[model samples]
Target: SVSVLSYAVIFAASTKLDITRKDSIKFICTFAILELVIELLYISYYERKKMISLLKGEK
Candidate 1:
């Protein structure tokens, strides 16, 4: 995924800088978690109509 790739790039860049190892890991993990939550909400919202029709037995 683009997010994973971007996180990889960010981690690599951060490691190259003077930032501590723990901070870089923390930053990457935070972004990854936020992305996951956002994607889940977005998927549920966009698929709400389809889910409702299926629940009602619509074709």
Candidate 2:
């Protein structure tokens, strides 16, 4: 998430610096895809851990 946000900020700044439209679009799409993947992985890991704890009567 942090990485995604950082990339977005950098991309925005780069646009102001006169970066090409195509490059900006590419960067934004790449970061968005990466962010989605990271979030999915995180959610899956968290849910699995929570389920394990519940089954063990730890929560």
Candidate 3:
């Protein structure tokens, strides 16, 4: 949602901001990659915590 809003704002202001199509694509792609990386880190952390809890239960 935020990404879309930002994209919309960038596009709406593109003419005034003198932003090129290539730059806009790059910005959107960067945001997507960063979001994916963050999501993966969170998932990894949750899985590790779950495994630790399971191991503790086996004691």
Best by lDDT: 1
Model 2, 1-59: lDDT tens per residue? 88767887978786897779898888788878987999999999999999999999998
- Which pairs, if any, clash in model 3? none
In terms of TM-score, which candidate is stronger, 2 or 3?
2
lDDT per residue, candidate 3, 1-59, as tens digits? Answer: 88779767756665466678788778767877887899999999999999999989942
Q: Order of candidates by TM-score, top first?
A: 2, 3, 1
Question: Candidate 3 overall Cα lDDT vs. reference?
Answer: 0.79
Give candidate 2 regions above 4 Å deviation.
1-8, 16-18
Which ten residues in a row are the worst by lDDT in model 2?
10-19
Model 3: per-residue Cα lDDT at residue 9 = 76
Question: What local lDDT does model 2 show for residue 10?
Answer: 72
Worst 10 residues of 3 by lDDT: 9-18
- Could you give candidate 1's per-residue lDDT for residues 20-53 as a string of tens digits? 9999999888888988999999999879978998
TM-score of model number 2: 0.72
